[model samples]
Target: MEPLVEENKKLKEAMNRSEKNIQRAHRERDLVESNARDLEYQKVVLSEHLATVKEQLRSKSEQLATASTQLKDASEQLEKLQKVFEEKKVLDCVEPETAPQPDGRPPRPDIIVKRCKTAWESFKSFNRDVVVTDATHALAVVQSHYPATDLEVIGGGYAKGLSEAKTQRLEDEVEDTAKKLAGDTDLFGETNGSGEA
Candidate 1:
């Protein structure tokens, strides 16, 4: 009976040790699973951050490309405008001298004014001469006297007496004024004489 009791005591101690070891193994497994879950959460957060960074980079690149195209287009338009302005400058350089060289320097403003005055005088003389010729005709119809040559010469010849230079200048002035009224347009818009912004 004493040997049986000792053997029973040893078996009970062994069973207790086995139960403790099993509990320790279970605790170790729980710790390992908790660490793995934390690591997986960290990986998921890193993945999200990386994706957001990539999207932002793509958006910025697209914006940069759009702005670059706009800038290039604006530069080309500016170049075209500058070229138009240069052409207008050249035209301005050629615009002032209208009359032939014989009537050039001394007769620029003075000759133009003189031609205008001559035209006015010729118009007034034509009216006055016609009135006189008609009065004479009415008198002749009432048995008065006047020459046909005088009427013919007075009616049309008064206007033909202007110098060729003055006549040419008057025509040129009309042409120049007409051309000036017809202006030019450019990229920005129209200008007075030159194609500037």
Candidate 2:
């Protein structure tokens, strides 16, 4: 009976040890699961942050493209304006007397007349809104070489003729008589008719 009782005690101790080991294994499993959940949450947060950063990068890239296009357009317009300025500079440099003429005796009367006519024509060919301003500049070139009387006779006459023609045409149109004209006369006409007989 004493031997049996000792055997039973040893069996109960072994059972308790087994139960402790099982409980420790369960605790370790729970720790591993908790660590896995934390890692998954971190991964999700990092992925969302990456997405936000990528969207910001995409938006910035689009803005840069738009700005680059605007810069290119402005550069082209500046180049065009520069070309126009250069052309005007060349036109301003032309001097009737210094310019080569067919008969070089103080620049023949016909040559001077031709130069004035060409200058007026060139002014008229410019944009209508800027025609007067451009004409004033072109006339300054003439004023530099010729006497004031010559400038008045040429530049003043051209300005007066253009203004009067425009005024007369507007008056004729207001009177409903412009359609009966012989032809569409230019600003400079041989006969100064107000689009009527």
Candidate with the greatest TM-score versus the true structure: 2
Tens digit per residue, CA lDDT, model 1, 1-197: 99999999999999999999999999999999999999999999999999999997765443333322333333444566556555545333333344545735453544555565566556545544544443343323322222222333332321445676764454454444323322231322454445544
Quote the lDDT for 168 in model 1.
49
Give the whole-model CA lDDT for all candidates, comma-separated: 0.51, 0.52
Candidate 2, lDDT over the whole model? 0.52
TM-scores for all predictions: 0.44, 0.47
Question: How many angstroms is residue 81 displaced in model 2 relative to the true structure, after the best TM-score fit?
Answer: 2.7
Q: What are the per-residue Cα lDDT tens digits for candidate 2 across 79-146? A: 66557666666545555454445655554444665576577556535534243333444444334543
C-alpha lDDT (0 to 100) for residue 14 of candidate 1: 99
Candidate 2 weakest ten by summed lDDT: 174-183
Highest lDDT: give the candidate number: 2
